[model samples]
Target: NTTPTAVADAGDATEKGGVANGSGGVVASGNVLTNDTDPDAGDTKTVTAIKFGATSGTLGSALAGTYGSLVLNASGAYSYAVNETNAAVQALRLSTNTLSEVFSYTMRDTAGATATANLTVTIHGANDAPVLAVQTTTQNATVGSAFSFVVPTTTFTDVDSGETLAYAATAADGTALPAWLSFNATTRTFSGTPTAGGTYGVKVTATDLGGLAANETFNIAVSVPGNTTPTAVADAGDATEKGGVANGSGGAVASGNVLTNDTDPDSGDTKTVTAVVFGATSGTLGSALAGTYGSLVLNASGAYSYAVNETNAAVQALRLSTNTLSEVFSYTMRDTAGATATANLTVTIHGANDAP
Candidate 1:
């Protein structure tokens, strides 16, 4: 009843005609019959159980012949293994209880009928979460501007294509999404114009059909537009001061805010003073007083103040001596780009306040 076939190739292996390759080490046998049977032999048959990557075992019962288990390990998909005892079968003890491995069996009838076959069994692991390319990104927008952020198709990826993946967005603090923004779970995007200028932080989570999840956070900065270049009121303004009097105690001193006096159209714009210089003077005392009559300078509110002494002889000599006094000065305001805006600051001094 002994049935023999062509010799098995010990080089290349397949499931039926060769041993399929595996990750964890596994003991496989030669390719033969899936289930062998013999006519004259009784229904009784022997099965050779070769544990390729077993954790622990007595190394008993898995008999191919009286010699030993015919489990020969080689680096080939197709290979032949003969029955022999003490073949030094290696058992790489993997740490986990779940892994995929192959088990080969050789069944022989009592009448000497024999066949070999193998099957793969995988000890599955817990489902895995998809991975994202970026956990955070920052984008800029202006108030009232159309704003939108869409997650790229490649934002989340899973090795298992069989598992369906979904996306959800929420506030990073787990409270709620930004007031001005809305999240689309299907598109994985954030949309809506920002109501005001500020920073909005959001978190997005990706979940697989298996319930495995991963998340990422994003930062968005919204600003008021036209702030890059601020505009202020007229670049020019005037201030006057009476001459401090040496004649009987009559003098003129005046103060004014140069900035508030001007206009600033840019809602979020601010003006700053960069430089102040007096120009050529004219009029009766203009030459003698010139830059002296008044000063051009910046105040706390980005404005200027002018003054004069009608009583002081020097001040009076400049104006009262000639019946009139005049002087001119120049100043520069800082633009949004740190540039400068030049303008004139005029001051007039009269002899009216001079001592009789």
Candidate 2:
């Protein structure tokens, strides 16, 4: 058979317009050998090889291009696809620039005679969607306090040239904006002095003129000032065994943290023992105070040590009568917001036998 002549046609396609995934768009579908000819009675020609410039490719397989891929079949059918994720391919979305690729293929006849032809694929650029850098966030506000947040315009980006973005706000559920908050679409700002304390969800969207959009969701927590005061619950100390009446040394001591049970209405506030004293709020912390039957030493951490004065008349009397005596000490706790509360710590002294 005589050598076969291969002929290819040029095709055009729009980037990302072919398939749902933009992987490839069909340029033109027709038999590659329909326009080819073979001299010798009824000698048929079939595609045997494909090449792009100096790079060789296999027939019936997909070949990668500078910004996309192409596949050619032995039957002469072919497809071209744009790589949407390719950085260079993405750059095309910035402008109306077009890119082209030339593919050459060889067709062989029955007698092993072959010829080559060229097919050109032109890819037209298209617009890309905007993307959000920060997807979700949480903000804070306070009742009767000024709260303001500005959307990060620089974080939202669109690759299209000369493309402008518009901002909008809605409830996180895509409803109307909350009544207590205000948003400026022009300035991309959120500002309001909330009258109530609650968690408000917001959705901010950045949209291009093409209606392609990107959005982020966030929450704003508003707190009521001084709504809940610090609570100081009365605490008890470990019981102590009374020392002998004749014993001149200190008896078994009792110690504990008086602020352990203390709390604040606000979960965020931390309660701390600001003062520990007897019958008053202003007392030297970490100082020892004399009680009826014992001396109590208290510290700023709400830890107090009470030592029974066994030699005292009242303490000695308790041992003789097999009785119990208790000493009460006062402490003051404060929250981070300066809310203070006072509570008492009671330590009981149990009478014990005196040894000879």
* Candidate 2 segments exceeding 4 Å error: 1-5, 13-28, 37-43, 90-97, 108-113, 125-131, 154-163, 225-356
Local accuracy by lDDT, each model = 0.47, 0.71
Cα TM-score per model: 0.37, 0.54
Candidate 1 residue 196 C-alpha distance from true site, Å: 2.2
Candidate 2 residue 318 Cα shift, in angstroms, is 66
Q: How many backbone clashes does candidate 1 have?
A: 30
Task: Please give the lDDT score at residue 297 for candidate 1.
Answer: 43
Deviation in Å, model 1, residue 326 alpha carbon: 68
Model 2, position 169, has a per-residue lDDT of: 93
- Best TM-score among the predictions, by candidate number: 2
Q: Which candidate has the highest lDDT of all?
A: 2
lDDT of 1 by residue, 1-356 (tens): 66522122332211110111112333344333323444563455554334444422122333232212333322112233322111211111122323334555445565656665553433322234566654343456678888888888776765542557788888866878877899888877788988876556677888876576666665566656664533334443333334344454444544454455444455555665443444322111112223565544445255455556433455555434336565665544443323233455556555544334
Where does model 1 exceed 4 Å of error?
1-115, 120-126, 229-356
